[model samples]
Target: MEITIISAQGLKKLSFFTHNLQPFIQLTTTPPGAHRSHVYTTTVDHEGGVNPTWGDKFDLSNIIDPSEFFYNKCSCIYLYLYTNRVLLGPRLLGWCGIPVADFVDGMASVGTVRWLSYRLRKKDGSKGHGVVNVMVKLDSSVFRKKGGSDVRWLPEVNVGRVAIGIPVRTLPVVNYIIYYKTIK
Candidate 1:
């Protein structure tokens, strides 16, 4: 998948009193706790404009294995904006969740670029401070379904052994123990 961040609108200031500000996107193509090698970031917009144009495109592949498990469970792409301050640390500006599957199907049917506008949201899913506009296209040439499952709902378990010992003289021993080792 090729994701292009065309622009953004209504970026919030880091503080009401300060004038210096910078902004950028910290983008990820998968839900939380997934792999991170697919993350894409843009350079900070140093002009301090409320609306910034990135015009940056990123390729997303191998973020999730194209298997039944991931295909069924995977949902959205996350976009987070931050303020790159000179003296102060980066501040979270806002976030947005893009439903990739919903748009990808339509893009495939039309075989054309898809443009979308996602309302920025806070971590709590309330309306945030901005809106992001993007263009995306799936590179069918790089798409492939590697035959394997990326996840297992239920894991295998190992069960075995027990040992019991009683007190002897002035020494105390293992009262009870279960010992087991997983087999390959």
Candidate 2:
């Protein structure tokens, strides 16, 4: 399986003294109650400076177990965004984790780019200063081929423009929301 870190927006500056926050992503799987998991990272975005853009693509052929991940038992992918500074060292900006099963269920088609926004959390799980916007693409290799599966998600809609009466051609922005309900 492969995933791409397309770009990031609305990043907060960690240090006021230096505007040079070199950011990169650390991808790993966090199985519930597990002590450790496999991790990978993209090259630091040094050129784009703050709010850097890295079209980095990484493959997780060795990271996950096929049997466990397929069953949605231990398939969480944790993404941690960090800034590697020269003097101050690495600082955690925020982190978010999504279930690999979320995509494997065909919620998103192959080659589709989903703009996901996750809340920034510190090492202690407290709120951070900024929100990270990431454009992610799961490679086609993960999708099952030639299946008669029905799409469970709704049709793509430009909700932002629809509510404000803006034409779809003029504004092609979409807002996605996920709701959670506890089942006893």
Candidate 3:
């Protein structure tokens, strides 16, 4: 399988930060009910300046066109990105499979995500992972393509975009259903 690495720095080096990751305010997945927290709502300053308008991360626009990406010079492929923080997970950017128009049944997934939420740590020191709600805010990035299977993985892009919201996995919790829409 061929892979493509989309970068603002250079086609060769993917390490150098070139200011391309933008954050968009929306959710990747929403079960029956999940709170809409203002996780991301900011703009990016490309000049490498300190103190951004909203946060350190820039709001990334969701890319639906597979044409914008070039992989192995030829073969078309779907694109998705994940942040260093994989606690949240990956999201679908674009692919040649199914168009997004047919997607979006209810709470449509908008962008890619890699949540940084503070999930429970493991006693064995491995990594406690699950959809458990805690008193503290999760250091999450957000994920896309929850109920659907359109999700892709693009580790080439270090950090991508995500529409902020709770994962559909945590929908069963009574607290989630009660405070999904009210909080904004």
Candidate 4:
């Protein structure tokens, strides 16, 4: 899996001395059953202040177990927004956890780049002032042909019935129904 840290918006200034925020993002993820988490950091954006853009891409293959990450309900990619301080150390401004399930839909839309934004949260889990934008892509290798054949296997899908209703003055009512079959 690969993720691009595009930017953040509406970030609150956490420092008392300066309103100018030199913010950067740190991403961490721990695979199911793994003892340690993998961490990646982005370069600080000095000029962006309340809105910062990094556009940094990181490969998370090292920490991701496709089967576990995509299936485990507890799997999440944690994002922490921080302001770099010369002497006081990095201070956490806000953070959020993005569940791996958020990327599952993109897997079915193979070769498509999807950008998602999540609201940042305070230390106490309250909604914070910033939103983080990121682009996620599943590696192509994940969809390689099985059994050395040209045919590629797709993930199984289960869908329910959807009904559309149309109201007509003359006919009273008309219904259009579409049913999606479960793909295995």
Candidate 5:
């Protein structure tokens, strides 16, 4: 599975007097029955402050076993938000868990790209200040034969079931915008 840490919004500063929050995100995934989790991180966004965007992509195909990580009900992708402070080191802002079941349907949909948002939570599991957005898709190679030629599955667009929600109207709309591009 491929996961992208797209962006975060409305983050709260750790200190009352702090003006700038240099935010970054850490993604951790632990397969069911595994003793240790694999961790990946995005670069710190110095200018975004309250709202940061990082198009960092992590490929779990090599690190995790698909059968164990995807089918296990207890598996979760943990997201931790932190602020980098030169003198004090990194401080945890908040964290959230994205259950594998949430996107398992999209993965089964065969190359479907799913967009999701999750609210951050404090260490005690209370509601935190920010929301994190991510894009997820299962690699097509996972569904094919090992010795056969690589086959890429194209995403099916279901126009009848699509609903457009316009929260903001100031921006110009582009028809049939392509959201995902395969690298390599």
Candidate 6:
């Protein structure tokens, strides 16, 4: 629950034209299958980036208010960045860590992932190795799958079985399907 790295801009402050953004390690708390209109609150743009599109006007509400938006937690952020490069942290920044004129040229650098083995049958039965809850690690430059094909959400991370849109329900979204996985 210590993810920080916001303040990346260059291609004219990027209004729209992203490549990667699977950065999760959430837990400001909530996180399960989120979507009860996904309440819980950390202000994540009204718990979920209230109505946005195109140049998706950034507004995650001043970095999660009061801290407590853990609706369906289980993401752990680790795609760093790829699509030309941006691996960040643990190596003084990898893939060159942002500097291709700020991205938006050809874009190509996938890092693929998958290591889920979750297990936590708790209601009282209590059994675990680790699953304190709240992780939320999504992929594909911030979920996108309406018109699909922004290169078709490139992320064969490691292929599990079936996963898309954080265990979604309804569809016809504006853009949403950057798959990430985890749930205890």
Full-model lDDT for every candidate: 0.68, 0.64, 0.24, 0.78, 0.78, 0.25
TM-score of each: 0.68, 0.62, 0.15, 0.73, 0.72, 0.17
Candidates in descending TM-score order: 4, 5, 1, 2, 6, 3
Q: Per-residue lDDT for 1-184 in model 6, tens only?
A: 1222222221111125433332222222122333322122121211111121111122232333211222212222221111122443321011111111112112243322211222322223344222212212223433233344454432223322345556656777597679878898
Better of 4 and 6 by lDDT: 4
Best by TM-score: 4
The runs of at least 3 residues in candidate 5 whose Cα sits more than 4 Å from the true structure, single-residue gaps closed, are 31-36, 144-184
Better of 4 and 6 by TM-score: 4
How many residue pairs collide in each prediction? 0, 0, 22, 0, 0, 20
Residues 1-184 of candidate 3: C-alpha lDDT, one tens digit per residue: 1111212111111136623333112222121124433222223223312211223232222322232321112221121112221344432221121112212212123242222222222323343332111111111122223344454432233122456987766555455445446665
Error of 1 at 19 (Å): 1.3
Candidate 5 structure quality by residue, lDDT tens digits, 1-184: 7889999999988778888999999888843234645678899999999899999999878765654565566668888899999889998899888876676654544667899899999877899999999998777654544466665332322323335886665878788966998999
Candidate 1 residue runs with Cα over 4 Å from true position: 30-37, 68-70, 109-111, 141-143, 147-184
Pairwise TM-score winner, candidates 1 and 2: 1
Of candidates 4 and 2, the better by lDDT: 4
Which parts of model 3 have CA positions greater than 4 angstroms off?
1-19, 28-184
For model 5, give the 10-residue run with minimal summed lDDT: 152-161
CA shift of 119, model 4, Å: 0.3
- Residue 52's lDDT within candidate 3 is 15
Q: Put down candidate 1 lDDT per residue, 1-184, tens digits, no spaces.
A: 6778888988777668768557788888655445655678988777747888888888765564334322542457788878776677887778887763544454433236889998887766788888999987765432445654342221122222245788457766668878999999
Better of 1 and 4 by TM-score: 4
Instruction: Write one digit per residue (lDDT tens) for candidate 4, span 1-184.
Output: 7899999999888757776899998888843234545679999999999999999999987777665566555678988889988788898888888876577653665566779999999878888899999998877654554234353534443333346898546855779999999999
Worst 10 residues of 2 by lDDT: 153-162
